[model samples]
Target chain A: MWLDILDRGYRPGTKLLFALIRLLSGQPLPDAAKVVFYRPDFYGTRAKEFTHEAMRGPSAWSVGDRELMAAYVSQVNECAFCVGAHTATARQACHDASRVAAVLTDLDSAPIEEPLRATLRMLGRLTREGKAGAEDMRQVLAAGASPEQVKDALAVCAAFNVTNRLADAFGFERLTPQGYEAGARHLLKRGYR
Target chain B: MTGGHLPPVANKTEGIVPDEDDKQAAFRALADRVLNGEGQASARQRAGAFRNHGLAPPLAALIGKVADRPAQVTREDLAAARASGCTEDQLFELVICAAVGHSARLYEAGLSALAEATGEGSPGHVA
Candidate 1:
């Protein structure tokens, strides 16, 4: 009762963010409370709609770059939670899950193209060493990424750190393997994979 | 690098997401009763039994009535799942389908943050 009240006293600000987030994610507020709320960001779309945009925003920069960076960060956290979750999400994004799996598991033989692979290697160092520099990305640019792509790569890598930490710190409730598979499966059909 | 014959990125990769109608109905139900119907610590206790066990000492078996089952869920079942390292919400969120669109964005953003967190947060999966 106490937590429920605390959860429901929806005044606004960050609480609104979580409420909108939860609402958009499809698990809306419970029935009695759903409608009584003054204002909620329903987004007039399914949970996946908001997520699709959030997930793809990085690609406005580069494809393999974002997926690779997300996967890389999840792996860094050793978050059995986020690592597995994002691996599935990465699968939906079009990069081979096999490569993500291999990379996540600590293998160097990922199937990403040479340039992308170079980028991943650099990301690996950056994630492990604290930060990256212009020289760290020289190979990335040489491999084919532009200055913009280089910038986005860093952003994607940084974003993964934030998400992975959130998932790990909170001890994210997990889905069955079947559940994980279904996530990618659904995205594939809907076109956001 | 520019034109690496990487597989052409297509939007769709796999399954039939529920229709918008189903999704909306589900959202309404979700917002109203689903999450509130249960308790977090309670749900987590059963689901997190394995994790708790990983940290707690064992106790002798006791003869008693089985733990009461929630309207549909039972404690024993949750304990069993937890012992196997299962989780509840995030897993389900990862699986639920969205409308057929934005196929390209499935696991996109968040990389930068993840990497940053890994390095700053913990020793694993950082880069």
Candidate 2:
């Protein structure tokens, strides 16, 4: 990470907690998690709550779908760490590694429903341009997404749009594939809390 | 129709919708907490980060990078901002503000687009 504080400036309690986690897990915690723990009172508390709700709250989109959107947004922003972490999580949540891979590789040709494809398209445009037009929303709606689904998808987009930038700004260290899979397992079990 | 040259109703409601979902509400709260809530960075710095303008040279350049192109942000940017006499905590808060503000802009645009597409609001209100 870019900040030394984030790397080693955890409060004593947090440090002890991190040590226990490392002892049990046999690996250091991911930097993304570390960022949240570094300053929970400042902004991490709300950020964690918002991200958890966005990814796990009541919504039309499945957990896998939301994870896929997170990965896609991260990809658009060129945040490799987020892409790896979320792609693994998406694969685990959806139980279809090939499908996740296909979507990431070539979304247009990916084997997915039209509704999801349309939503991802809209999200991609918004992430890249930092704005989307009414016509874009119309396409998603016309693709069979209810208004609520659009709202849900935008929630995911908004969350990752914040996270991807944070990952890059803090320079989150990229984990190994195994590390990503482990983190993915934790996310599946814990749901970003 | 009776009022002379009244602004569009959509313009009056160009931001977050009144009835937001749980996720939307949470997202808004997160952004609000970072941009408007108490933190190490001054209110001026936080607002400047959100607006992507109006700050001293070091922080201004750093916020611009985080808001527009975070992938391009380097350790040097953080160092320079810190060198401007702001602590690491303040720099971190400003960076969070920039990222959250960028997302808030897109989030609002998205909600407005959905409103316009559904004919619930008018077009040409977004910048």
Candidate 3:
């Protein structure tokens, strides 16, 4: 389900940067990346800035935890492109990639701390149901998560909930395994901005 | 955690960025324009589109489908929107507006839940 928007140089500045990135990497930019480049001045810039702040900005949650939370939300939403890209990023940041994968496949049995698991369950509810109530937050807090960590984790979940819908609705180009790895590396190094 | 109370949802905006208030105001302004401002889509059409999560008639059906089941969106869906007279840019704007609305609701939900848990205020009447 991909939008038919032309994925080429449109804006002068974005076009130049895309060209340079393609030339250096020897690979085309992913549709997810190109989609935002469409209106860099409008919502695109804001979306990117907010994503950076949510995913890579300073927080009690580790980058890995945030990435994993994003991947988990994508998984629940069934956005394959985001699930692949963010899962790769999560794997890179976490001590154990398999654990992340396990959680994705089955959260109940995954080898994760209780607080993070509780938070992830909260995210799942948020994504599927569009709301997680006070009881959910209380459970997470009782599991030992700090309020700051819960807020940061929810921000990641909320940001991805937006991105996942955009990617799916627009029909983002699905990256290959190699492309996913490369994309993950780029995000890890440069961050969302 | 003694004396702890859930902070207001509006206050959490600061945690997202240093200038979150400005950013949020800008986003809300854009959203208002997109959803409520004049455009090619008629006022009725825009309201129905926002409510139904698509434009009108057959197109609204498709938009509703996409809103409900995003993964089911395909080239056919895009082509249908185009055939219904939606330009690429309009389609892009619609998607952003719908998504931003969804995100806002989620943020409010989390904040409300947290506020309730801390016994600070009721979910909707947070203060």
For every model shown, what is its TM-score relative to the native structure?
Answer: 0.43, 0.92, 0.84
Q: Best to worst by lDDT, what's the order?
A: 2, 3, 1
For each of the candidates, what fraction of the native contacts does it recover?
0.00, 0.84, 0.52
The model with the greater lDDT, 1 or 3, is: 3
Best by TM-score: 2
lDDT score of model 3?
0.72
- DockQ (CA atoms), all models: 0.03, 0.70, 0.43
Candidate 2 docking class:
medium
How many Å off is the CA of B19 in candidate 2?
A: 1.2
B1-127, model 2: which lDDT tens digit per residue? Answer: 1111112221223355445667766766676667666788888778788778888888788889888888899989989988989898888888888888888778778887888788764433333
Over A1-193, each residue of candidate 2 has an lDDT whose tens digit, in order, gives: 9988888888899999989988887778999999999778777888889899989988889999999999998998889999999999999999999998998899999999999999999999999887888799989999999998998888888889888888988989999888899899989899888
lDDT of 1 at B43: 32
- lDDT score for residue A126 of model 2: 93
Q: Judging by lDDT against the true structure, name the best candidate.
A: 2
| Candidate that beats the other on lDDT, 1 or 2, i.e. the better one | 2
The C-alpha stretches of model 1 lying farther than 4 A from their native spots are A1-54, A58-65, A185-193, B1-127
* Tens-digit per-residue lDDT, B45-100, candidate 1: 32222112211211101000111111122234334434555344322221111111
What number of clashing residue pairs does each candidate have, in the order they appear?
A: 53, 0, 2
lDDT for each residue of candidate 1 in A1-193, tens digit (9 for 90 to 100): 1112224545667467657745665443322122223222221133223333334543444444465566676576464555655677677666566776766666467656666666667766665554454455566666776544544455455444434433332234456675565544543455331
The window of 10 residues in a row where model 2 chain B has the poorest summed lDDT is B1-10
